[model samples]
Target: MKQLKILVIDDEKLIRWSLEKHLSAKGYQAIGAESGEEGIKIFEQNHPEIVLVDNKLPGIQGLEVIKKIKSLDEEAVIVFMTAYGSIETAVEAMKSGATEYINKPFAFEEVEVILDNIKNKLKIIKEIQVLKRQQKDIVTFDHIIGESVQFKQIVHLARKIARTKTTTILLLGESGTGKDMFAHAIHNDSTRHDKPFITINCSSLPETLLESELFGHEKGAFTDAKQMKKGLFELAEGGTVFLDEIGEINAATQIKLLGVLENRVVRRIGGTQSIPVDIRIIAATNRDLKRAIDDKSFREDLYYRLKVFQIILPPLRERRDDIPLIANHFITHYNSQFQKNVSHLNEGVRAMFLEYNWPGNIRELRNVIERAVILETMTSLQPDNLPNEMIGKIEQADNSSKENYTQGNIGTSGSIVEFNIPNEGFSLYEIEKQLIIHALKKSDNNQTRTSKMLGISRDTLRYKMKKYKL
Candidate 1:
């Protein structure tokens, strides 16, 4: 936090001394100047938070000083002091950008009141600036860049439900598929846009703590419960409560949550009274809740209640057409963030992105782009800028398509593998699995050599092996 600095400019030494003394005692860093010209020089050097100027001064008037200060910094707060008590002069001072005008021979209490009001106004302006930044920083639906048919349908459905009075919404997706971002977009577009939007991860805390965090607790409810506290449900009021990792909550908590969803009310852990809450519950999870229900971990009734408005996000692999759009969006984002002029990805780099399976989804792509932008020196994103895993995938794709490639397999005027399209069709997965096996056998089951030969990262190779049960 910065110290509040006040510049007191008065031709009378006694007035300047008195104000400086009083302000300094009140924790303000106050400076004194004998003339308008001197005050302006001090202001230019120190940039005080508040300026106090006497109307009648040598060389320049207080109104002129306020205009000069305002010109230097438009947001400068200025106080005009005058014993002349001329309403016209006060109006002129205000027009010249003096924040407040004080008549001289006034009590210190009056001056204090004015100063307090000015401080409050400045605090409010600062808070509004922070709030505006936060609101703009939110990942709204507009920020979700997608163009594939699957991606478009999901976004379209989400937008429709966002404006509805839906009590419960369940967002299902793999990890890093923007489930939380969707929740934010829904709340921002809803009727409770101006209200608080609180979010909590269900799996972050233990069951006891999690329950207390959601519904709050009465005073002395636990060893650490010293004061009566409001939970996220009560705090949100008519806003929204986003429960991420909804599948991770235990069955007991699920029942309580279901009751809340079914009755629009929540009860504190130690309190018997059911408090009515008008908040929307937006639950998201990367886990397979349907499977959890079959395993008797998640409540079936709770699942249905939360599934009133369901949204299933398509993974990046399923929306290959949107990869370029998303990648370009990340390029633009990183360009601004890293202060680099990354205009676009090169043709080969774009091909690699399109061919590679983004198992980590958008978040993985974002991290890749961020790293590349920081490392890349040229304006365009080139092959060298991509992660090794993606580079390996590029190699794998090239090896599969190129002719006369004889790294391990020997064939004349033909590639390592050849395939004929059957009328019944071919399985791409089987083709990929066979390629991995061939590489492994050629390397004598050496993972590192196999990864290098196949042109994929070792980690990716291992993941593929597990995926194919090799």
Candidate 2:
């Protein structure tokens, strides 16, 4: 940080010089004035961050000087100087905008202590301003790069619901499907964009700690709770609270969260008062919460409440046409990040990305591009720049499709459909089960590859597999 200017104003020449000299030696750029009028002129010209003024002055009183300076800049940190006899006047000076008052005979050490405290506060304020700017500029609808119809529709729908006063938004998607991005974009696009957008992953903490974090505990509420604390919901008032991995919360926490959703109020663990909170709740998870509800792990009522504005982000493989476009976007991003001149993916690299099923979705693609950008010596991304496992997976898929096609299996795309119907009519369940088994066998029992062969999510395949007792 640059040197902070401190203005010292006193009627006595010695007091002004002594304070300025002491503060100047301490690294501040301290200046002085003989009278309140001179101090006002210097203050308006230089805009010093801190001001020290005396109670009795030649033309104007110190309290009057404080008011005038405050009129010019309300954020000015002013400390009043007075004698033992003028303590009453010091109190009056405080009422008129003085930050603190010290006796005239006070030690220079006292002044240094006050200045150190003010400096700490100024540093904190500056850091907060920087963080706010970064948050405001980082995530938005415009930054979401997708040209596919499904992706565009999801974005448009999210934008529409963001403008509303919807209390709860449930983002359903697989891991790495950009649920976190959607949560941030939705909050940044909402009416409370300027407020804090606090987020937490419920699964990251133990059940007890997660409960305490959500509904803050009072002092002495628990052994380690030394003081009263405000929870994220209270801190995020007038904005949004993103609860990632919401399905991971336990039954007790689920009941409490349901209360908050119903009443828009939260009570600390050991407190009696219900603090009202004005915020939207954005819950996201990669789990099949509907299945969890059936298994009694998730509360049905809470699911319905959170699903008021549900948005399911499709997997990356479902939007194959956007792979090249998304890859180019990541290539440009990593190019700027790593200071590289990587232009675009070569045709081989492009086909490898399209041929492979991105089980990790956009996040996986981003990592692939970032690695390629960092390692590639040529201008354009090449096949060797890709991960070896990706190429291996593609080779395996090609061989499996060919083998299944040669076996006269209709599961492979563009293959002829030739299945004999039982004379007594076939059972659809048996046919569907056999097809999944055949696909799994050809794909070497890999869930990701098997899901791609069946044109479904890995989670869906697991559910069907469980249903068919396979």
Candidate 3:
């Protein structure tokens, strides 16, 4: 660990010498300055972690020095050293930004205890900074996996908009279509990527609490608000604030949000001061805001404010061509997570995946693949390894389609024949052979036409012919 550097600003020579001697002996690097001006100069030169300022300095007062130091470094930790008669001055110094105050003629043991407490607070602050950096690293654009045409188009647009620092982005999509992931990607790719990226689900909290969470509150603002707190907007200053399920926020909150978007300033609950914030707002929702506006549930002006640059994420069913790629990506991910060696999905599994309509979008597909990867005991994922509900849904769809075809209701021209199975359970192989024979006879033994009619590849048709001895 690095040694903590301290600056002591005192007019008295004995106080400065004694503090420097005791602190240096305790493994702290202490620098002494006579008067507040000299102390401010030393603070700028060395940038000490802690400052001990005497309230009754000769030239510049301790409160003025505290204000100057705070202006230089807002996070600078300061402690005021005051005489017994100057307790009110010390309090004024604290109001000016000094972290703590110590009385005159105090024991060295009390100073030691104060220094120890300051060290602990400094450690916690450092840890929080490290965690914020880690969070920024984790939410980068590289984590979003997709190569489909629609997905790539959305990603390209996101990357393009991410270069702008002040643009408001709206992500419109279904519940599980990865809107949150897109929000993260936009933030991590933006100019403010290194700063805090705060997220809050607008629907998750009550109206009063949501307002407090978004706009923050002063100490004693409410019954439970025992201390002052910074809201998501303040915490995400110089970065991004992601508001998920934004449609769920009430009308009053929506009006406040519009003011932030317009003025870039937020007022804390029960606080008169309006704090300016530099942040990009990314709001996402599954609900239709236009319909909500028509229903008078959501404000039209707020909706337009949020939709400055909107990206609508397509559902998974609309992008079926990307399923195999996404499924394999999830398979590889889960293989490492579960320590399994499952390689790929079987042909039947792939066919079933293609036939099913994924109502829950990419999230549902990921969950299904994760479950299959965990349960698979073989080298590949099979149809039997899929969830029973999924298999049943596919079977029901097939049955419905077959029934529609038999009733001559499947096609616009109504030219297809009704195919019925016997009650005794006919052989599937025999049925396939008869269908191929009839196709060949109808096509006058022309392999191309026979293959076309049978809806099979020419190679598959030839293989079946040889196997059936036809």
Candidate 4:
């Protein structure tokens, strides 16, 4: 470590000499100056790490010298020394940027301790600055990769609304369309960035547990109620709470949630008093909430309240232009995460990715890339790296009009094979089995190509293969 240099400026010759001697004995490079002007000159020449100036000086006052030194180097540590009955001046010095103030006739031990404390504080401040710089430099937008106009517009809207204090946000989109990713991004960019972001899938939890999970429960609230526990709302205090699969919440839970939204308060189960809470809410659902209200499954007032800032994410097929960006993002992401050097996707792979209707949206794309990265041996991901469903859709152009196959088939898989005219109709399972075999043949038994040609998940295709004893 570099030796600390301390400059002492005082009109008293004895005081300056004594302080200089004491500091030097303690392993500090101490310099003494008779006047504030001389101190500044020495300070400019030596650029001392710390400055100690007396309140009374010949020309410039102690506080003025401190200001000039600070103007030159704001990080330079400074301490003001004052005689008795002039503590008011010392306080004014502190407000003027003095790191510390010391009274006259200061004890050598006290001075040493104060200097040590200043050094430690400066070290901590430096460390905090470095950490903040690193955090600021890191890229947080790695997950939501897209360049299409529709995708760009959605991202832009999310950013704008994130700055607002809107308590409720409704994210409407089909399953796997990256609604959760956008919700997280909004929370990260909002004022609650430093606070907790609690996410709960309404459909994943049972009704009884869902109520307790969202709004806490007092002791003895239910048969198995062991102790009091905070719920999602209280846990996410001063932050945001994300409700995924909002449509799946039943009417009872809906009523309770509505109370929280309207009153900004929640009562624990079996508790009489309601406690105020501060929480922003973001709700996501694939179902049409308005229609659900009409059906009496959801409350109309809650629906309108949650729609304060609405964001409707388009499906992957609707934003076809973003395929390459999304694919390349996945390639880069999985490469680092999986420790694979997989570089790019081949032309055939890219075509299949764009042509296939991603019913699962971005979620399906991520899974595809993850699988490809794990199974791929070559530097580039070829068409075979994808699932059978994706490949099947790419090659099913001629047979597109079949009722069994829609533009975006959820899990349907089929193929063309001339079969003998049968007297009885074939079972759904039989027809499905025939389609898989024909797709496999058309792709020359290449599972990747066959899976793409079949428009089914590779796992599904494999399961069917074993089922048919192929």
Candidate 5:
């Protein structure tokens, strides 16, 4: 665990000594300063987590010190220590971003209680920050639902590359194939997981503003630039910077980005000094960069720079075998989110899901499941609960299949099969058993291929085969 560092700033020698003694006994590294100026200098040198400022100081009042410390680090937690009859001053300190106030002439026990309270607050704050980072990073691929060979291979490659420190990664896929999720997973799995993971979409901003946003600017760099500001690259030092839609960046910005990749340094928009940065860049794009290079829309050198390690995420249509698993994952997720008890997708809905091409990929499927979960009252998601577009596509495919079967075209192309149920009502278990046997025979008893043909997992097929005494 990291030790807590505290800075106690007071004009009174006894108060400073008492705080230093008590804080040190409590296992904190406490430093004492006799005035506000001296305190600011110490804070700059030490960068302590907590600062205790005396409300009345010899020079440069405590409120000014609080303001200065906050200006240096906005998240700096400061507490104002005030004498008796200075409640108004303490309130003013609170308004100036002081976290809490400690009244003077207070007992040592009260000081101990206040220090413990602050320590607890700081701990909770640090935990929350870590939680937020994990939520953003781990949730992406931690519970990724897939068992298809192609999907598994992609995940394996991603995991293999995530252990490296400096390899630039490029995710190539369609818009909704979860490139951002892969980026987050790679960052979270890397050595810089504790550091920041910053994301910026290239196409979301205009060219000039986008440049400034990435490289930052010095004071008076632009009409709106009033003070020096750190850019995303500077802020994400020792971590990952995920640039989504990297192909959309303009030519000039592309040149600058290429420089950053080659030199590992960034220059502010109007500043001359080149600040070195240590960051892992992970870029994603749906556009064809090779074609963009041909058309002179993207830089070829930069494209090669970004593709040092590339992962192409397969579209959902190609991984239909994983739909059921992914859908069930969403059902479980939305059950807690929307407070619904939807346990599964009905048979008809499941069939429709397998038939649909899923042109928008996983994102569209997640949205569909979320909608169904929100509006569904039954225990299972039904076909009618699906979107109109999906239902129409499924119905159209069903009609086409029926027409083909009527024309005796079933199995002619070896792509379509027709099964008929008698009016007396056949057993679903019997039908499923026969289908499984047929699939097994078609695959030459290859369970993996059979599972793919049935759009189920190999484990599920194995369990069913055992249950059916096959």
Candidate 6:
């Protein structure tokens, strides 16, 4: 066992001697001082882990001593021993940084219990600090926060793939499902963060200029070509180029991209020379690439090439277990940005957030929190600050499903349920089943329309269908 060091300070010789004897007998190295001034000097020299100071002391008061000790070592634990009928003084002692405010004439057993509690707390804090330090080594997982088993499995998979030089990684998910964030994580975690990470929105850009923008245009290549320009591929040499909305690329553009992917070279439009390039490719699509391939809207060969390392990000609704963590993360970020001291979410707000299907996925949730933080005061964010559309839904849910409703949408019957168990409670399966059934009933069972209304991955809905024996 580790040796415990304690400093006992009091003007009364009997009290100081008694404490020293009892603590020493309890296997502690005890130091006694007659006054607060002497106690401070003894503490400075001894560097004791714990201090027991009398509230009434000669020269300096116990609270002042605690403040001084705090200024010197913020982690130092000080227990203020005050006489009876000084409850107010004890509270003041606590506010001044004393670890515990105990009445004088207390029994040794009570003091011993308090010391044990403090020791346990300190042990937990030390473990937590060590864990935090270990986390500093992690670069990508910091942004992806979740205690859910599924999310953890995803992180585990991502970390393994990130260490490799995989060229094609197709991130499939719904819009606002954090595909872009995961793309950034993959790029940063990979061996190519030092190089440029160029992103192209195939759906956003015009097809006419997409080729030139991707492969560059030479001087006098076209009407607006005043000077030579490097395309995203050339600029991303020895790095990664993220093609978002890859499903939106036309067949012609797809053929061109296929050539670049296959040959690792690009020819500037209106230029004869083929420029050799070295770059990794990461593409994302909210659209079903397989469906596009089946429809002949996308090339099957290119689809195979992009699927070398496919990662499907679950929509926010699919991973409802992650909502609390994600919500807290956004709340922290918004609180800091908006300069609000708001530290916690009300139970009602949390309940509503978890219950609602985030159609926009993570993006939608982040936007809602950001908006609420900006618009609402430091006081509890009432349901009003939420999206106006959601308010109606929440109201309806509240009315019909008296258990589930917090004044939102058309509440379906039997929507409200509580879960509690010894250590283990409700399974994610049960909650998700209930939510889906409610959403379907609410949306009249239109799968496509229901998916949009629920803000969940269609794949997730299908998977649940099979899981629930639908």
Candidate 6 residue 370 C-alpha distance from true site, Å = 1.4
Candidate 3 Cα errors over 4 Å, as ranges: 1-137, 411-470
Candidate 2: regions farther than 4 A off: 1-137, 410-470
Which of the two candidates, 5 or 6, achieves a greater lDDT against the reference? 5
lDDT of 4 by residue, 1-470 (tens): 46789999999999889999999998899999999999999999999989999989999999999998888888879989999779789889988899998888888887888899998997898889998996664334445787766778888888888887655899999998888888888888888888888899999988999999998899999988899988989999989999999999988898898899889999999899899988899999999988998899888988988998899999888776577678888889899988998988876576667667788898898899999998898999977778887777766852553444332242433324444435664555666677788778888888878876765545445656876877
TM-score of 1: 0.73
For residue 145, give model 6's deviation from the true position in Å: 1.6
Q: Estimate each model's TM-score.
A: 0.73, 0.65, 0.63, 0.57, 0.65, 0.56
Q: Relative to the unseen true structure, what is the C-alpha lDDT of residue 234 in candidate 6, on a scale of 0 to 100? A: 94
- Per-residue lDDT of model 6, residues 1-470, tens digit only: 38889999889998878888999898999999998899989889989989999988878898999999999899999999999998999999999999897887889998999999988988898899988995564346578787667878887887778778746889999999778878888878889877778899998889968888898989999999999998889999988899999999988889989988888899887888889988889999999888898899999999998888889888887787678678779888898888987666665676677667788898888898888878877556666678898777767754555433333232243334433433554454565577778778887887766666655545446556666876
- For candidate 2, the per-residue lDDT at 389 reads 90
* lDDT, model 1, position 202: 93
* TM-score top scorer: 1
Give the deviation of candidate 5 from the true structure as CA RMSD.
Answer: 12.3
Query: Which parts of model 4 have CA positions greater than 4 angstroms off?
Result: 1-142, 401-470
Clash number by candidate, in order: 1, 0, 0, 11, 0, 17
lDDT (Cα, 0-100) at 219 in candidate 5? 97
Candidate 2 C-alpha lDDT tens digits along 1-470 = 89999999998988888888899899999999989999999999999999999888999988899999999998899999989777678789889898888887888999998889889988998999999999677799998878877889999999999998646999999999999999999998999899889999999999999988888989999899899988888988898999999999999999999999999999998899999999999999999999999999999999999999999999999887688889999999899989998989886677677678999999999999999999988889989888999888999987786565445575535552467655676555676688889888988999889887877655557667877899
Per-model C-alpha RMSD: 10.2, 15.0, 15.8, 14.3, 12.3, 18.3
Inter-residue clash pairs, candidate 3: none
Worst 10 residues of 2 by lDDT: 408-417
| Stretches of model 5 off by over 4 angstroms after superposition | 1-137, 400-470
**Whole-model lDDT per candidate:** 0.86, 0.88, 0.87, 0.84, 0.88, 0.82
Better of 1 and 4 by lDDT: 1
